[model samples]
Target: MTADSGILVLAGTPIGDVADAPPRLAVELASADVVAAEDTRRLRRLTQALGVQTSGRVVSYFEGNEAARTPELADALEAGSRVLLVTDAGMPSVSDPGYRLVAAAVERGVRVTAVPGPSAVLTALAVSGLPVDRFCFEGFLPRKAGERRSRLADVAAERRTLVYFEAPHRLDDTLAAMAEVFGAGRRAAVCRELTKTYEEVRRGGLGELAEWAAEGVRGEITVVVEGAPEQTVVLDAGEMVRRVRVREEAGERRKEAIAAVAAEAGLPKREVFDAVVAAKNAERSGA
Candidate 1:
């Protein structure tokens, strides 16, 4: 690629501690041709903290201006300018405002690279005491109650660990919703103010965590919920019918009952229905 062939550099800013800033971050911040920061004021503080002076032009690239500013930044890169992107914290585009610019750069044949750094997702997961062998990053849960509950229900049976970002004010309600859907006894960890002075990681059943969060919480919150417990016994055809019957007796319609049982057993609803029907036929034949 030619020197002026435009390059997009995404840098990970320290989530909390300035000491975590990598040497390469300082180098790029000072030497890049253009720097796009989520918050220019925060960028100034970071530069000052790192004792690094940027010779590049600084521009805001937050959620509000990301759409309008994207084209301008892409043009800079196309002109062979080295553009560095830094979010307010954590990696860009992880529930932040870096995806659009990155996508724009890639579409225009601009080179894209990143400076590896601290990540709250990884940090929280590591310290969550939950299974990390397999996990999913869920970013932030939906804001509205109905939508949020619907979304949480979708993952209620997810077997892999889940990581999510949540606002402080809504932590209690979110945790409560998680408890209602995922189960009151499901284990979880809430890592708050990670890498900061008041950092805390609370681990407990979803029910207890909900109660705790109800008291009060502050700062950035990352939740790591343990996956559904491993099922020791696979549901045989007969057991599947019984499970569906139990749900049906509990006031669920037959269709909804089958679906609930199938979701719990990680099976298809049609499979559960056939099993229940087969069991009914066997009973009639024996009679």
Candidate 2:
């Protein structure tokens, strides 16, 4: 058997509490040949907490410098360096800047691994009291209102629970947009502060949450929305097609429209697709 090449270790740090840092993380930090941190200052603080001295070289790697730094890191890994990548919080390259480096390393056949520890996505989903068996991480929505709403239109039918991260100031607008796109009665939970003091989880319908958010919310926020309800065979198929067509006309592609319709109508994709196709063909044949 062949030995593995140098590895890219993606280390996940704590979101709020430093004590939450995994014990193995410190060992990796002390032993790694190259420590790539989002913020060197924070890395120093973490090292201080861990009381681990790094004998290897330490370098800054983040959003601004990621593109330029990737090749350098990849070279070190190629030279048999155990490259350890850490972000400000949570996992690296997860809505963070480590993707470039990871991609470059993977392309060169460098082994990639992780010191899995804290994750806001799973933490929020776990504590949100929503179904966690199946879910999707949406990260963050677009900042603009129109773009955000249009994006939400795609997941309106997602049956497996949905999760998202949102900014404090934009919480109200985001909740309102979700209410409009996902429906007023859709159940959701907003988790804030995570594992820190003042950690909060607000659970309610999209409409109520929107109203509450209008008063303002603070701290890091993660929102989990219940998937669209399953369709009852008795529901109107024609109505579902009409609604899906509306979304399609609003810049959503046919697949997205069909998905939305299927979710809303609580029907299978084939059923919705057949109805949509038949409706289009009927207009073409003038039947």
Candidate 3:
């Protein structure tokens, strides 16, 4: 907060259209003592588009060199230099670089501020036709098939709308995984090339989207999926046993089935296990 201590400004750039750049962004770009960008080439294009020239030292601060560069930026801040951090798009550090620099700045007791601008997550959610009342930004799914499926399974029962960023090439695989884990019938929207020419928002069930994506999709992609429908799960022992059996019939091991059912029903695994055991004993005795 002292005049001798510099401040870190996190500036948000356009996700697609260059004009979405905020007026304040230009001001910060022009006046910052140092400008850190995710991509120097992209930053040049942006500055040219905005008709503004950065007067300060501009350096790259991407994932590749973020760790090494953060301390340097922090040192500049401590020396009372105005540091502006801008990513390739959107705010720095949403799923991009800048988190490390921001943390370093904070740790050094430096002031931090931001120039809010366009966000793909918000833009996709607005047009996705899915419930946005409460939602979670999942960033991106794992690239590996098994890891991605496991990640999806972790949130299969999430009731809040889900949003994810994905590469065009991986769209089909990601959507297919979603269909398998979140259910083929689950509603979703695929927003592509947002805020740019040829922008498109495709809304449908996960299965349908997966099919469409299989044919090929291009450009930046954002997916918004409807949350799991609320279920009136009876907590009785009979209901618990029935749920476990259903999962077991679907080829899940008994232990996995019990754990999954317990998670879905918001009950302890031990409770579901006990119910299943009790039901099996009763059935055996009755037979």
Q: In every candidate, how many clashes are there?
A: 2, 1, 0
Query: What are the per-residue Cα lDDT tens digits for candidate 1 across 107-146?
Result: 8888999999989999999999999999999988889987
lDDT of 3 by residue, 60-146 (tens): 999999999899999999999999999999989999998888888888899999999999999999999999999999999999987
Screening candidate 2 with a backbone cut-off below 3 angstroms (N, C-alpha, C), the clashing residue pairs are 231-266
How high is each candidate's TM-score? Answer: 0.86, 0.87, 0.88
**What lDDT would candidate 1 get against the real structure?**
0.89
Clashing pairs in 1: 4-80, 6-77
Candidate 2 lDDT tens digits, 118-173:
99999988888889999998989999877787688767777889999899999999
Pairing residues by index, what is the TM-score of model 1?
0.86
Better of 1 and 3 by lDDT: 3
lDDT on C-alpha atoms for all candidate structures? 0.89, 0.87, 0.90
- Which number leads on TM-score? 3
Q: Largest lDDT belongs to which candidate?
A: 3
Candidate 3 TM-score, true structure as reference: 0.88
lDDT winner, 2 or 3:
3
Error of 2 at 171 (Å): 1.3
Higher-scoring candidate on lDDT, 1 or 2: 1
